[model samples]
Target chain A: MAIDLNGAIAAIGAGVAIAGGAMGTGMAQSGIGSAGIGLIAEKPNQIGIALLFLVLPETLVIFGFVIAILVMLAGGLI
Target chain B: MLRTERMQKVRLLCLKKDRRAVVHELHRLGAIDLRRSGLQLSDGSVGDEVQQISDMLIRVGGAIDVLRAYTDVKRRSQPTPVKHMALGTLLERLGSYSQIGETYQISAALKELDDQAEILGAAARVANALAGIDIDMASLRSDVLSFKAFEMSADQVERLKSTIGERGISAEVLASRMNGKEFGVLVAYDKKASIDDVIKGIAPRELDITMKELHGKPKEAAARIARELAENAKRRKELQARLRNLAAENLDKLLALREMLEIELEKGNASSEFKVTESAMVIEGWVPRKRTEELESRLALATSGRFEMEYIEAGEDELAPTLVNRPSFLKPFDYLMEFLSLPRSDEIDPTWIFIISFPIFYGLMISDVGYGLASLLLSWYITRITDPDGLMYNTAKIWELGAMSAVVFGVITNEYFGFQVTQLIGFQGIDWTKSITSILAITVLFGIVQVGLGIIFGIVNARRERENKLVVSRSASLVTLVSGTLAIAGGFFGLMPAGPSIDMAVLAVAALLVTIIFGGREATEVTNLITHPLSYSRIMGFGMASIIIASLIDKAFTPNWAAGPLLFIGFLIIFIALHFLNMILSIFEGIVQAVRLNFVEFFTKFYKGGGIKFRPFGYRRVYTVDADASDA
Candidate 1:
């Protein structure tokens, strides 16, 4: 139930990494999502391509998740 | 199965009299994609014929629309059997359907009736509004007095009456409740007075009724309008009944005529692409190489040896259309390929790779027995209800396959709605609680294999295109990707001896140099060799997220059986609903991420898809048959 200073800082760093990556992903996807809706409205068959574009930014969050895992391992928390 | 069907360019020269027969035969075969001939020839006659058929098509289309609006014509539950006939015979049959003219007249009459009903409906509304006045409508239109009808709130009418009285205007004001809060006020004043300004200041909505047209009292006029509206409705019904009967008798014939006319129009338009002389015409098209002999025999039979046919090799500069034939089960993946882009005729088709990896990715993302079973049932239901030829049905099949894979993984992981199912049966399967590191390692390794395969495919494609530089560069990329991955694993993770790790790192550096020397601008993508494989870490990330979330839901919402029945039942319902929501999210994320990994990450390495789809000339007939028995 208690944590050392180093452990607490590692956890905070992991949270920041994930939060920053998620915010960046969301920002990038907003423009792509709106433009993709317009494209799909004009050409419904392009739904697959629109979806692909909309999800392309998700790798940012995935990378953040990997970093968080590494941080937890270094702090002996996982 | 990895490559597209080969194609050959075909040129056919025929006598002018036999041109129609040859074109008709080609249409029935439905194997060739017609192209414009190189010779410059006038197509005035063919253009005229195309215009004629197009006009007929428009008329037929209009009639079908009219019939559909009037009646709920039953769609055929089963596809209609095709009727075999020559083009001339089909044209004659279309001409014999006399109901076409009757339908046109009926459509015009219906349109007129609609316009009349609209006008009458508006007049009826006005008459009903004025019915409470109990005054002769014609008398309200006196030339010697200023008459006006205003609709306002009852309180506003009271204010207007008092204000007009205060203004010392000798006028008669009549008020009647129209509906709800609305009061109709009619004011008549001396024509010479300036009382119009007083009424306009009230800001009431003025009604525009032609008083001169209503000769009788307002109530009488309302009755008359209602009667006229009824009469119009009756006439519309009778006309609609006649239309329904006509539709019942001729709807199928009209539909067949429309199809035939469309086909004829396309054939006529194709003639514009042919080279025509005074007594001969030439047609050029692309045909699948395997079907060339069939095309030759069919043309020979159709023209009785009057046509001369020759095959030419497609030039290297020309891009031929891509055509790939797969079994029925693999057809759904083809839809995915088409949605992205078709592979070039000479490049490898990556659909087979997707078929192998997409389901694996999906299974890993949503590995749970209960969720997999639910997805399988949902997909099966969608497939049953959707059209077989439509995109929805194909996508459902893809989901069905992914669900099966999910079930297999779910068994291996011993998960059922996040519960350890094997624990109840006195055995233990793979405990995800202890296998996170192993799973992450496996996912990263899978990424390495896929990326390596992609680079190898790129090498094969470059070699096929005789791009020697691309071949060597891509080979170097594969070597670098493999050796660099091993070096990282051994050096950083201590998976092997330090000596081998150092040696692998050296090999990786040497491969990187080769890549830079031959890869041109592509060498700048060296960092992607590390990051792209690391991207596969997402599979583990999402899979663990799903499991953790499901477990949390179960922990939080599980009902206390020891509580009273009512509270326990309430909590149980909430528990079921949350689990259902989690399952749906899992399905959605599973499909999007699985397809994204394949299309965006795996495909970018080698696939440069700008290939034209092979669209053979001719309609897929539902009501008409191929006249040539051999082609059929």
Candidate 2:
């Protein structure tokens, strides 16, 4: 259960990476989700198009996840 | 399976006398999408008829709404059976129903009763609130004195009395416990005293008994109001019964009449799209090639062999509407296609490809038997409750298929709610902890294959469209993707020998040059050629996250059998709740991510979906049948 300073820093970095990505995704989706509701209210059949745009920003978080995994691997943690 | 139904542009010429009949037959056949011919007819009769039918529709629609409101009939899950009747018979039924003055009279009487009942109901409520007060209701509204009644807490009533006393307002306060735990206070003061301000300060709700109808003591007033209410109720019941009986007798006929009027209105509207001359009418539209023979036969019957018909090939610049017909099982996938966009008539339909790949992506993302079974049950329940024709039901069917795929993958992986069932059976299964790299490779390879297929499809589409530059660039992009993937595998993963890596790297560079040269401004997408396939690794990432979260929940909340009963039961509940939450997350992420991969990553390569949907001119009749079908 004891971790070296470098290992701790690496874990913290991974956490920060994911946290930053998640917050970015949340901020982007907050605007999209609200606008998408308005769009769907007026034209319900555009729900699929709305969802496509809504999830488009998810790639940012996926990249962060990749980075987190890479950090863990480099840190010999997983 | 990969293309929309073939269509032929059709033009028809029929005698003006037979125009309406031919149009009706065409609508009944439901084969052609009627298009507007450029020629305009100056005839104002069709416009007048459209207005007349519209007015009739409004009256019939109102009657239907009124009748439906009075009845407690549940909507039928199956469509109402069509009653075969000649057009003339339909018109006769409609004419008879329209002339029934009793239904309108009943509606008017019911409205009058409702108005009366509302007034009486309000008086009854106020009378009930004023019960047990002995003062004359008229004196409470006297011009020389002011009376205010309030329902408030006992403490608030005491405070109000003291507040009035402090203000030096000469008022008589009567307080009594009303229903429940609240007190009713009646305050009387001189009209000149400005006591309203003092009462407003206390913030107690004041009861209004200002209606002129109440004159005697509260009890007597209540008695009079009750009598009126009973009479009002009696009249309402009579009107409602009459309306219900009217509905019972004429509801079906009224519905049929409405259908006939709506159809007549549609024919009138469609006539505006026709090109009319002094003695002839011309109509142009697209018809599915397979249905042309049927259309010709039906048109011949309708025009009595006096119509001329011709079919022509669609022009290259023209965009024909798309129509794709699939088997019942594949119908749900059609919903997915429509969700994103429909394929252009000339482009290959990617629905069959998505049908095969989507479930696999979903299964890999939600690879656990317990969650899979839960998803299946959940989707089954949703499918049962939702309308079969709605998007939600189709989505549930797709979910059901994905859940089955999940179960298949779960069996292969030996995962059951993150527990390795293979361990108990002493059998070896793919272990995520030890085989992360291999799993990542497989997902990436799957991504490459799909992306490669997309590029190949792009080339095929471009070649068919005779866009030579597009074909060359797409071909180069495909080569670049393959060589770049091999180079990365060799250089980073040590999957291929170093010599092949050098050759692959050189080939990748050459392909990129060709892509840049031929792709014009779209060459900027060269970066996506590498990043897109790598994006599929999120599948493995999300699946691992689900597994790790489940494992953590198990470790943190799994009950100790040695613990006492209460503590053990508490932990067990938390354990199940956490697992349920995890399953929901897994299912949601599985669907959104799987669909995202196909729609955004794979589809962006080839799909340029702005195709119009084919909507033939016809109403699916529910109450009336076609004349020819009726004869049959």
Per-residue lDDT of model 2, residues B290-408, tens digit only? 99998998888778799999986666577898888988988888877876788998897888888898899999988888889999999999998998888889989999999999988
Q: What's model 2's interface RMSD, roughly to a tenth of an angstrom?
A: 1.2
Docking class of 1: high
Choose the strongest candidate by TM-score.
1
What are the candidates' individual DockQ scores?
Answer: 0.87, 0.60
- lDDT agreement of model 2 with the native: 0.82
True contacts kept of 2: 0.60
TM-score for each candidate, following the candidate numbering:
0.91, 0.88
Per-residue alpha-carbon lDDT of model 1 for B247-292, expressed as tens digits? Answer: 8777776777677777787787778778888999888888889999
Please estimate how well model 1 matches the true structure, expressed as its whole-model Cα lDDT: 0.83
Model 1 regions more than 4 Å off:
A1-13, A30-47, B40-45, B82-96, B150-153, B177-184, B192-205, B211-213, B377-394, B423-427, B489-501, B564-577, B623-632
User: What clash count goes with each model?
Assistant: 0, 0
Largest DockQ belongs to which candidate? 1
What DockQ was computed for model 2?
0.60
Q: Which ten residues in a row have the lowest lDDT in candidate 1 chain B?
A: B76-85
Q: Which ten residues in a row have the lowest lDDT in candidate 2 chain B?
A: B75-84
Model 1 chain A TM-score equals 0.97
